[model samples]
Target: MKRPAPRTATTRHVTQINRTAILDVLREHGPLSRRDIQQRTGLGSATIERLCSALMEEGAVEAAGQVRQSVGRPSTLLRFASSARAIMAVDVTEYTARGRLVDLGGSTLYEESHTFALEGQDAGAARIDGLLGLVDRLASPETGVTAPIVAVGITVPGIVHEGVVTKAVELDWQEVPLADIVSARSGLPILVENDANATAYGEWHSGALANAHSAVALVLGARLGAGIINEARLHRGHRSAAGEIGFLLTSSASFSRYFTEQGDVDSTLAAQVLPFAAREGLHGKRIGPAFRAMMARCRAGDSEAEQARDEFFDSIALALVATSVVLSPQVIVLAGAFAQYSEESAEQLTRRLVGRIPWVPRIAVSDLGFDAAITGVSALTIEHARSATYLA
Candidate 1:
């Protein structure tokens, strides 16, 4: 049912491979002499020199400084140019829009945000305008990001499939052709991802799970969910609904008055534990404070809080165990709100999985914190920029 891929390895292809190799080396370990690059990449002296020259001409690599050798004249040390180009990454929530302009080497150069209300008949159109306006504001030359932005990557708080947002409850959006619209309006390539997936990829690629090629990231914010990376790839499943762990059942109560739906973890938590938290005199504008208080109480040795915490872990443990049995990930990463109590959360989840699974995966906490998604979107944009028709 599938067509075979065409095989065509021309001289150009080999040159491209060598070029990519040189760039990768420079990115991983830079400020090295030409001889050092030859030694590391196994490329001949002529090829390394040629590729480095081309890369420097294209603004991807530049001279860091001169290093004098004991036996020869001062050798020029080369490094990947972090500010050669820029990537515009934005995160869109229900009420807030935050964006950053990052360089090629994953450094934040500038960031900006503005709040807007999504109301009335033209809310969808207004949302689009608001997003574009923010992009224009950040892209202004006054922000001081001088490099040309090659691509843009944005995260939406909903299901994104095939360049379209199928649904976003908080934003009241459906079947929005987000990527096409944005790319057309901005005159650059666009990448669209959900917030949870973006967070998971950001953590795995450069944050908590950077060392682990395959890991599971649990997003335990006001709403609970999971992001999965398998063999260094984001596993979106067949319909792009792979990591929706909020629908997992912890107790018998999920069957009655609780159906498996999108982002149902918060509802499940409230049904099972909020009553106990309320009884303890914890309330706030949103569920975040009360939930945080409950987690704290449980760690202080409160019986009721511990019971509720265990129940909460029950739901999460089901997802982790299932993910472990299937993918055998190297680690389980705690992200979002739960990351604040990563040690305790990891301990509780480990206790639940000690005997159930043949072996337990190590648990880690995300280091990027609230910036994970933005970092991830920026990385994705860089990748797209490299593979784009234009030269890096």
Candidate 2:
């Protein structure tokens, strides 16, 4: 047998891995003495000291004073310097661009929201300008945040591939090079992700799904979108469309129609009571007030409103059954305006879902609400900043 070749040196790679490990430990466990880091990382005391010294010199870690031991000299505690750098996160919605300046510990340093007209001439350019202005406002010296911005993470309502928006029906955008354009203007590393995916990642990182092994975050609004997490990792399938559930067809209509047309609870209620409203000479009332009146009638035992409510529950149950069968997530998180439903509606939907699906995942309403996507993107930016330090 031929003699095996000698192993190539991997000292640098091992050192990088250990450095990252040390930083992660510090971040998770808070400040730790050098001895504590050594025990947690299984690295020798000398190696830990050497790495910690380098990190401290690089402004990635800092000594937080000393702890007196029982029998030996006091040991100095070290912590990951969470405020050493900052991240810029931008969330692009239908008509507003929201930005937040965040630190490594996921703390918001500053935030601003800018709204733009979506139907005027050069609307796309106006939206881009709005986003850039938001970034400029947050990153300016006037904000009093001394940390340098290391990266930008943008969450958009579209199919993003390698920082490009393949399609965003809401924005009427197609094949838009969003990341390159933003990077050119901002001069920082840029990452663009689908809004739903970002929200799911945000939930996984720090929200309701943080401890879940798998989850699906569904954004229910005029359009339906989903972000899937498997084994604690965001599952962006081939073409990054793993959770595009809007196109999934049901018996009544596509899932998107449920929230967009007569299938949605509010819209269905409006349609059912429109005849009643017209008969009562309430034709001038808008859908909002009509929806409220319909709900009131349902509470007062109106047969038509009750029928509409039952049909809405049935449609939602069918949609949930389809989603659960395919993804089988440990939990399903509901975000967007639909989360404002009354407790009775939630209970009814839950009962319907439990009756339809064999294994009913826990249904959760998002606490982050409108900030979920921005928060998730901010977390991604901080993660990128942390990785860059290791390379440095």
Candidate 3:
């Protein structure tokens, strides 16, 4: 095949960037008059008008009535066409694969989950098929959704470089051309990203770290991952392995053991505490019940329960201190299952880290929960779709 002509510093490319900028502004703070857009974007009135006209014509933006003025004609207000298109997002975890259809505004239109074995010869194919099936279900006309899926974004727990999974220990994957396979099978443009980076972007885009120009998102669960955002951009290191903090070795074991071992409150309560508690005459196996029981015991000043919770917090705080020293981010958002900790536990963890580090970053917990990765991927996919020449 003949190679396509290399792109140059053309007027069209510049216009496209400007258009994307306008869209971004509207997406963030919309229902603005053209003058407001001009003021916020520092673009000429004529340029804003031209871009708005094109965007409006393409169904990417729409006039949302007009802004009333005191002494002049009302100015037309423009807003992003958030419902005009949608993107499919898939998040592959150690034990499950989750898929969701989301719009430009990060609203979930549909979501479903499938459990799969994390290791074995068929694990990889099973995950791929599960994701494809989820997309098919969302796209089916029977679902009554009319918005078209313009792109697909998949977040994997590993190093993803140019759509390939260079390594994903959790899934036993190596050098898997994930994006190519998904795009070929689903017939839609695909973007593959590291799960931690995706989660961080998700939190930055719509969750706790939205206001931070520099932030670190630590996902503490079966796997410990960190996503770094510097100057409001995801900082993927030289080899796209920037957030694999799980591999960091500690004095006793890998740093991941702090979170992956019986350190997670829910997992610990379910796997270890519950069984032991049952043997000791407190028979509750469910996480909810076990967690409540543990908290109750701690509140009553039970030494054993408090000690367990304290150790968990200490382990997490140590990891946070390490991350803070390295990144010096303005904010650190804790995500994944560990975020389900009670407010007291979270505060305790924060308190534990107060004197450990010289600089303290505002620590927050993820509100998006397990959906962070998929949401971030959806946002990324939408960005790619918006920037594509064909989409423009």
Candidate 4:
């Protein structure tokens, strides 16, 4: 505290920026030529060469191949030396707990999941145990990782404030030091993030919205969670819980009430609304399983089934209309188990936007499937690692 770091701040800032740019290049278009990297980064050729050499020495990158497009001399292609490093990601949701071992390139090397009751007392402990089990599995001699574990990323649903679980209503977690527990187990650095934010990061990093610089990802599942990426950086507002859009009061008073009311409805049944739209049917398919089954039955030309689907589309349109009025983001990405339902939901959202708003955010479904959370956590870990290295 004795002002011992006068020039350290500037040096650290520069280092962080350099490293961030390097990592960003590798993430965007990896397995690149040194010249290509230099061109993309706009760094001096000598500096790029030095950085690449240093990174290679650190086992963060490796020569993958040579690009021989030009006649003069082929350029050696560099790829993230994935085998040389490892990171662990823990994804905790209301219905399941999953952990993945990822390489430096964001590729998942191994994954394991478990269904555990996250209600009542030992929930937090159980989750920690599961995560430890995952680390052990990946660190064992048989795993054959060249660089071992460098960091760990833990993602959980609910309001997370600086490594502490503030209010995970679904999991009944409160003020749990999740990051500390995981760090104690791994004896390595740990990063904790809201699961929704993680999903947004994943989508922004590797899913359908990867190219968008400004986007909002609304994850609809056990609870609706929103994560916003502004100018390619995760924006965690003042309290680190900035993207809690589900709590935004909709027609049913609160999102909890809205989602709760739909608990009894089977999502699979709800999906049929898409096909029904094709036939322009909606009267009988008001909302329920029988309506869903009827929609399915209409493949043979049952008019009523088609009508129910139309009504279903109308409901989705209303939701998207509300979302558009609020965020007005460049793009809106949907990622969750429920998102896998028929294209009707996405299509309906688009169709409703036609005349509803002067401008509409492009909506798309996440393509990363199960890997989005893990991928986002890995990206966050990579950024955190760069920051820590600069400080060192």
Best by lDDT: 1
Please give the range of 10 consecutive residues that has the lowest summed lDDT in model 1: 282-291
Per lDDT, what order, best first? 1, 2, 3, 4
Model 2 lDDT tens row, 6-114: 9865989888899998999999896999889988999998999899999999889998899996688998999999989889899997678888889888889988888
lDDT of each: 0.78, 0.77, 0.76, 0.69
TM-score of each: 0.81, 0.83, 0.75, 0.70
Model 3 / residue 27 / CA error / Å:
3.9
lDDT tens readout by residue for model 4, 284-376: 322233334444565668676667666645654555566567656788887764354535556766877887797888888887766777678
Winning candidate number (TM-score): 2
Model 3: residues >4 Å from true position, as ranges? 1-8, 21-53, 66-78, 117-121, 252-314, 342-345, 389-391
Instruction: Name the better of 1 and 4 by lDDT.
Output: 1
User: In model 1, which regions exceed 4 Å deviation?
Assistant: 1-6, 10-15, 32-51, 67-75, 119-126, 249-267, 273-290, 293-307, 389-392
Using lDDT as the measure, name the better of candidate 1 and candidate 2: 1
Give the per-residue lDDT of model 3 (tens digit) for 69-186.
5678989999998888888888887667887888866677887777774455487677667667776776677666688888888898778899999877567678889888878877
Encode model 1's per-residue lDDT on 329-367: one tens digit a residue: 888888776767888888888889999998799988778
lDDT of 4 at 16: 59
Distance from true position, residue 317, model 1, in Å? 2.5
